[model samples]
Target: MEAWLDGLPADSVGLRNRGLAYGDGLFETIAVHNGRAVLLERHLQRLAVGCQRLALGHDATLILTEVTRYAAAMGEGVLKLMLVRGDSQRGYAADPGRPAMRILQASPPAAYPVVHAEHGIKMFPCATRLAEQPMLAGLKHLNRLEQVLARAEWQDSTFAEGLMLDTAGRLVEGVFSNLFLVRDGRLLTPDLSRSGVAGVMRSELLAQAERAGIPVWIGDLRLDDLAQADEVFVCNSVYGVWPVQAFAALNWPAGPVTRKLQAIARSLLDA
Candidate 1:
């Protein structure tokens, strides 16, 4: 079977595509609602940072224009924008002159269980831990073997997500979402200095919390901290916000802070 790249038809991707040969690229999954892409600028900003760090040449303005057009046409769906280093020769070194290719796609947003957002969801601690790489710390690069392995640690629907720690046993993030904790009336999230993707929704929530007078802190968190937290939540662009009803045997009520954040997220995301 063949598919289209953006709007043009393409039978098959080139065999030497750098994204396939090596995960040499970046991708952004954006949520669309009422024919609009949510947090589009933030997504582009992250992609730009990734390009800069990875030394991949990309036209940010062009990508933004393409995404805007696609989002408006799709009306409501998930937009995945993948920027690859184009084709490369059979070697580890990349050609500096190769033009980047943008694979734009749109699909229906996932229909998550209502209980997950309302009553909250359960999480299990995964055995797989993320390795520290300061150079790749907060970029959502195409290389996601760590997340892939962590996600494969479980297969049941009982746990909506799995919590992954760093090599030093400090809490980092979920398999696919950014983790946050509310403790002693303060909002806390793991610092992504050494690992983890700095999610767009996470940044939005932090800004919203600040404007709303919520005490927010970003630092290294421990399992004991989660146990002592007054409330816990996880967020991503697609799912918005999901309260953590329980982790292992320790359970927490969805406190005011989490509910407030959820309300804010709904206003911005649910449309």
Candidate 2:
């Protein structure tokens, strides 16, 4: 894997970079297929929203241009873009006028077990819970210690992902993906207003569902909801969608809705 810092080949960032120092930044993991960035606009839109919410100064046009060029060069792979507040003095205070730093890394596409998407996966009941921070809820901020800890909870092939809940015990999302439930032909996903990431794939799925005449609901979700769901699945921009068959004592089959949405996700990622 190689990285580009500010559109130049680089292996390291400045010692005082705010992103390295305080995890002060946002990132996007994009998929590139046949020299094209998948969901490029949606990814950039989310990054723009994060920049606005964080008061980070960034040039959206420059980012788009560079990301496009990089993705073209990457062909079929994963492109990770990190935008940070640049270097600063050794303190919590940051210069508002400082230019942001852009770090881009390209790696080969992720490989997961075929059984995960075929027979479905068993989810680990993670004890790590997400903290409710409305200000930073939906943004893909650089601070990801919570997810780091949650992911570390499992280290076996038996579980494909971990189920994460918010501090208030509300069903939030997967360790690195968004959660969704299909109930009575309705699509239900957790609201990220107070916790979890508003994943690009999740947003896309909701829009696709609505356009396809599937009733979509976004709000608080509970374990009882998952238990009663007719189908369960988790999704990310990279891996698309994986049907979750088991979480703790509860189990579900990959039903018609899961298959339908999985196909939709497959088409999007493959496109």
Candidate 3:
């Protein structure tokens, strides 16, 4: 039995589409606002970069046209665009001339557990470690078994997210959102050079913090650093900023810094 592809169109693309065959692709989940995507350009730029890495071509204007059309049809919702290496015969060797296939889906944004947000999140020290793939780091690629496993680490709804570290035991990010720690009045986030997806809201928050006169340090972080952290928050484009209230007994407040960044994040959402 073919499982349903949720939120995707019923009109099927070929089953042999190389992307389905090989997972040779990338995707971006963008929030459409007021009939326009909040950060459509950035998402497409990331998609183009992903295509460039695989030697597949992407026409920015063409994709933009489709995105505009899709958003127009979907109205205000999350639009996910998947770009994949085009159909090809079964082989490990990629054909240099292969084009790309685009698949689009739209859905209402997953309503965040705002009640948990109000009380703040309960986190798990996830056992799953994200593999450090330098070539694939910072790209939202389709190969996400690591995330899938980490997400399965805790089924308890009390925990809003899970903290995933690298193989070296360095705190990298959460299961889905980018992490931030406040220490000694400075903001610190993990460097995505070795691993983790460079999130859109993560980049925006970093820049916004700088503009707000907050200094940021991006480097490897140990569990101890996070444990001793005065404030901690996780962010994604749709959720804005959610403070980590407790991580397996380490209690934290939605402090002044978290609230300040929350205000900044809300402004971007309202924009």
Candidate 4:
């Protein structure tokens, strides 16, 4: 089966499902290599947190078992695990008694240009500002209208990503990934307490940096701060890491810290 809906062969959900109607759900994009899901634990951790925060009931063990079974069948690709509030009649209030819906899908991971990984890619500073919602901050919820709108701001092959800032004008993240910067031998990432998804790769990089004796900080960053950085990078679970060569007029080389973190990310995720 290419997809499973609550452990059954299915490719579509109902029209009234809360996930589709109101984006009452969460999802994780996992990389599968050699019949095993990479960073499965981290993905599940985030999912659990989302479920708790949303007051949605989910079986973590069941979801993990199904994900493993599904990924093994479609080895060496991307696996998306989606948890929805389940099918409900026309209403915003979810029924706590109803069981949650789980979706597992497998797709071929995109074959990115090797040069993009070797060197780096240019990005456009998106004009779409993210609205700060503390309740939804850091959770990879199904609601991605902001990112969709930001991504639509540009359609040029020259720009590989779009950098977005929160409504308060603090740097947030890339449209589809987490942002990081290096300056004076310290690693700094935008604080996502108000917006943006706290990506699994971001978490891994923070831990790895600590282990590698690199000082790391999570704080509010502005465009000027990013421009002053020696090196910058964007990361996702599937793409691993992409060094930011330039954003607007500012330019930066793929410095030592970025390269080191990139290597570490590959090793950790590919293991």
- Top lDDT hit: 2
Candidate 4: where is the Cα deviation over 4 Å?
none
Candidate models: Cα lDDT each: 0.90, 0.93, 0.81, 0.92
**Candidate 1 least-lDDT 10 residues:** 1-10
Task: Give one digit per residue, the lDDT tens place, for model 1 in 1-271.
Answer: 1224644646568899999989999999999998899999899999999988888888787788878878888888788888889887899899776657888877887889999999999998899989999999999999999989989988999999999999999999999999999999999999999999999999999999999999999999999998789999999988889999999999989889999999998888878
Tell me how far the alpha carbon of residue 162 in candidate 3 is from the true structure, in angstroms, after superposition: 0.9
lDDT of each residue in 1-271, candidate 3, tens digit only: 1111223454576777767777788888888777777767667777777777777766677778877877777767788777777667778677777666677787886688676556678788899998888888998888888999999888888888999999999999989899999987799999998889888889888988999899899999998897789999998877788999988768899888888998888777767
Per-residue error at 244 for model 2, in Å? 0.7
Find the 10 residues in a row with the least total lDDT in model 3: 1-10
> What is candidate 4's lDDT per residue for 1-271, written digit by digit as tens?
4689999999799988999999999999999988899998999999999998999899888998999998889878899899999888887988997768999988897788887889999989899999999899999999999999999999899999999999889999999999999999999999998999999999989999999999999999998998789999999999899999999999999999999999988886678
Superposed Cα deviation of residue 102, candidate 2 (Å) = 0.7
Q: In candidate 3, which residue pairs get closer than 3 Å at backbone N, Cα or C atoms, i.e. clash?
A: none
Per-residue C-alpha lDDT of model 2 across residues 1-271, encoded as one tens digit per residue: 5799998999999898899889999999999999999999999999999999999999999999999999998999999999999998889998988778999999998998889888899999999999999999999999999999999988988998999999899999999899999999999999999989999999999999999999999999999898789999999999888999998899999998889889999999898
lDDT of 1 at 271: 80
- For candidate 4, what is the lDDT? 0.92
In candidate 3, how many Å is residue 88 off?
1.0
